[model samples]
Target: MSIFPVYQDVVSIANLSKEQLPFFMRHVTVYKRKRLHHHDFAELALIVEGNGTELINGKPHELRPGTITFLLPHHIHELHTTESGPPLQVYNCLFDISLAVGPQSDPELSNLFMNSVEEFPAYTDLSGEAFEKMKRIYLELFHEYSGSSPGRNALIRAKLTEAIVLYIRSRPSFPVPGEKSLQPHPKDHFWEMIQYVHNHYMDDLDSTLLSEQFGVSASWIHRSFKKYLGQGFLQYIHTLRLRRASGLLIATDMGIHDVAVEVGFESYRTFSRIFKEMTGITPSEYRASYAKTMK
Candidate 1:
């Protein structure tokens, strides 16, 4: 199996509903430091204007016009912007597909989602006339969604998915160097460390260990993590462990203690405290809510 996840241009709210999905939309102008937060929803960020760095899973992806970021559930990430000329315009959508309701829930659809290659789930660049068309599609989808009408929600979902598909197909599959790839960024080394950390989050994690593993000094590891992922090593590791814990809480029949230990926590008490801090709910509560679905 590939390590990367695949993205199918979701084109209909019906498709999302058929797949047991939930969705939300918003716009934000971001500037400053934000702590890492975890969510069960799949997220999409559409860059309508401005530029910045999007730190995802411990790597930095350049964010600018036409940049679309699809973040999987429990993917720890943050955003930092230095551009002062224009406020970064973005449309953020969060979704869930656990109860998806349409053709998109097909086996083929499920298979395709596992094939995502680039850290940025998908990318496309639009300028001049093409940019206008892209803007129109987004505006129309938002308008239809917000307006009072029967099945407007369904209509919005369908149009939004279509807009995403068309946007993905109309642009290049690979990002240009220095724009959104690991190849040319000064923070590429940080990406390597992130991949390493992700592969080993279940093990004991610390800066000294990661530093030695990466053949760098502990300070370098700490700084790089903050610079690239916007969080310290310990914070990032906790995020990873908490995310895994959530999966277990929702997907397993194991007791809370077992789930805690399985995800590398030392004790159930510690696990409970951290889980509550990150998710605003106890492990038992989360489990109670999603356990039936797991069954």
Candidate 2:
């Protein structure tokens, strides 16, 4: 069995109700370093006190009071407390990606969840008025999440949205490489298409299928993907599938064929060819290399 951990939403978050939005918050103190792990839900953590190091996707960043780290689904990360410093304390909030990029969400807000190949940094340092504002929102979010008041869910959503907007505002904006600055498109449903693919990548997806589903021509879908995402539809789907397959190879004991099938490939040969082509290693080799790292 693989040693790495992959946290699932159903297992990690508690008190989730079908009738209510999926959100959880807690005040946590880290005395020792956590194991390197990834989860299938989005996380926003505010450093409340102490000092630590956050290693995310193989990059290390210092964590101190007023620092906020945003982790998307499947981002491998861990937290380490300094030996001489006090424990790292933070307000950790977890929620479904849908909460951040739902159908009703604004385009700018929805872009925040598209971290597969991000144009912005994953974590940002907030200070002065920004820190104070975020702290207040987090406090209110905790209260609403723990309380049974009417419209609590709506309030929680509003606060979360506010927090996200504030975080975005705090960051320095940059144009996407090879593309002009993004603008809001009232009729553009690209984000909705992206979200749909993210949720259903394990299913058979193609331009024709997506075109039919979205009531647009296949060529339009292809052009939108190329213009916005810098990749074709098939490429995007393969990237998502490969990412999931890689995680499974490291975090589960599923067979190679099963892993491929789990991520939507029908033929083992095709899966192996594509896996090696993209990752430059066979599935078994990838798993074995990760095992070596653990040892």
Best by TM-score: 2
Alpha-carbon runs more than 4 Å astray in model 2: 1-3, 6-12, 112-117, 174-295
Ten residues in a row with the worst lDDT in model 2?
Answer: 175-184
Quote model 2's TM-score.
0.59
How far residue 152's Cα lies from its native spot in candidate 1, in Å, is 3.8
lDDT of 2 by residue, 147-169 (tens): 99999989999999998888777
TM-score of each: 0.54, 0.59
Clashes of each: 23, 0
Task: Single out the weakest 10-residue window by summed lDDT for candidate 1.
Answer: 1-10
- Residue 78 CA displacement from its true place in model 1, Å: 4.0
Top-lDDT candidate index:
2
Model 1 over residues 76-177: C-alpha lDDT tens digits?
Answer: 566777556566788776666432324555454344343342332444456766667767777776676557777776776676666545554564555456
- Which residue ranges in model 1 land beyond 4 Å of their true spot? 1-21, 31-38, 57-62, 74-77, 97-122, 128-130, 144-148, 171-190, 193-282, 285-295
RMSD of each: 8.8, 13.0
**Candidate 2, residue 251: CA error in Å?**
22
Judged by whole-model lDDT over C-alpha atoms, candidate 1 comes out at 0.62
